[model samples]
Target: MIRFIDLGDQILEGQSEFAWWDTISDSFEEFSGNQTWPNWKCFEEDYLLDEVREMIQDMRPLDRYKSLFPRDWSGTFVSAEDRKKRYEKGICDDIIDEDT
Candidate 1:
């Protein structure tokens, strides 16, 4: 199947040796009724925008794609606005998986 994944890599300091996840990170979506580590944030096919998926279909990622990935996180965004507006600041280190 053509997977529509919300690709991401995370770094949890002092967590594990392989904490610095790289390409093909865990999907944001689920499969087989559960989230997979090999892929964490995968976007369900039915939910993905047709145009965005189609555009991706026409091309393949080698290093990185600009349109496909609007932003590549360079540093920690710990500002109050960033925490509030962009990404919510977590209370603990443990990941809290929310069902959307």
Candidate 2:
């Protein structure tokens, strides 16, 4: 039973910028009772707005951030055999160290 408010005129022409605040307020109320990790009701509107505005202002284009990493960065995967070998080696090393 999610209910949304009609921001009608508040979303028109010169009012659209501030309309986000009302939208956020409505969403906060809508989800406040749910078992969400971040309880939106715990935060004040002004503080949330300030933090959101700052985050938006500080955001860079995704491609720009992506370009900072290696283009050939695909070595994070491991085969089943490699994982099994590593696990066996770890167990063997632990047993040897314990014996010593």
Q: Pick the candidate with the highest TM-score.
A: 2
lDDT of 1 by residue, 1-100 (tens): 1232432333333221111123464434332343322221332332243344555445543223223432443333243333344444565344433431
Backbone steric clashes in candidate 1, count:
12
Q: Show pairs that collide, candidate 2.
A: none
lDDT (0-100) at residue 16 of candidate 1? 16
Off by over 4 Å in 1: 1-10, 14-59, 62-64, 77-100
Candidate 1 local Cα displacement, residue 45, angstroms: 28
How much does candidate 2 score in TM-score?
0.21
| Model 1 alpha-carbon miss at residue 44, Å | 25
- Superposing all C-alpha atoms, what RMSD in Å does each candidate have to the true structure? 13.5, 19.4
Q: Per-residue CA lDDT of candidate 2, range 1-100, in tens?
A: 1222223223333221111122334543311232111211222233334434455335532233234433443323433454566668784332223332
Provide the overall lDDT of each model, using Cα atoms, as 2-decimal numbers: 0.33, 0.32
Best of the candidates, lDDT:
1
